[model samples]
Target: MVYVEVFGEDRVEKIKICGDFFLYPEDRVEYLERALIGLPFTISEEDLCAKVEEVLGDCVLIGATKSDLARVIKKAMVRA
Candidate 1:
């Protein structure tokens, strides 16, 4: 379970859960990413947390920060 960047290299990038996260159908990740795009980064941590929990309540969250995602990505990248 990890959070991944839903946005691209463009500005206003955001984070989202990376795993299956109880999302049905195979395209849910792509859908989630699209849902998060264009959202401002000005959102507070508490607000973001609440939003994430609501959107990904079924997800087994790895942690509550980008650093956690980075760590997981790093490990995956290394393993690959």
Candidate 2:
């Protein structure tokens, strides 16, 4: 597994997976980021929040708060 960080003003910081592999775009970290391109960072805070909400909707956040995010990431890393 690989790790990635997402950051923006008013956006919750996060670390995501760039799943382990040895290939082209699949292994390209930038490509993984590109998947999140067009997210509403430049829009209103509500828009950004909505975008964040949408993204996280597909994810199962293991904890209720940021303090546990890293631990969740680490657990995912080990399981991978």
Segments in model 1 whose C-alpha atoms lie over 4 Å from true places: 1-28, 62-80
| lDDT of candidate 1 over 10-41, digit per residue (tens) | 32355454653344443544554555565554
Clashes of 2: 0
- Candidate 1 scores a C-alpha RMSD against the true structure in Å of 7.4
> Which lDDT value does model 2 have at 5?
51
The alpha-carbon lDDT assigned to residue 76 of candidate 2 equals 36
Which runs of model 2 end up more than 4 angstroms from their true locations? 1-32, 39-41, 62-80
Candidate 2: give the clashing pairs: none
Top TM-score prediction, candidate number = 1
TM-score, prediction 1: 0.41
> Tens digit of lDDT per residue, candidate 2, span 1-80?
33445554433233354434333223333333454454433344444345434444444333132223333333432333
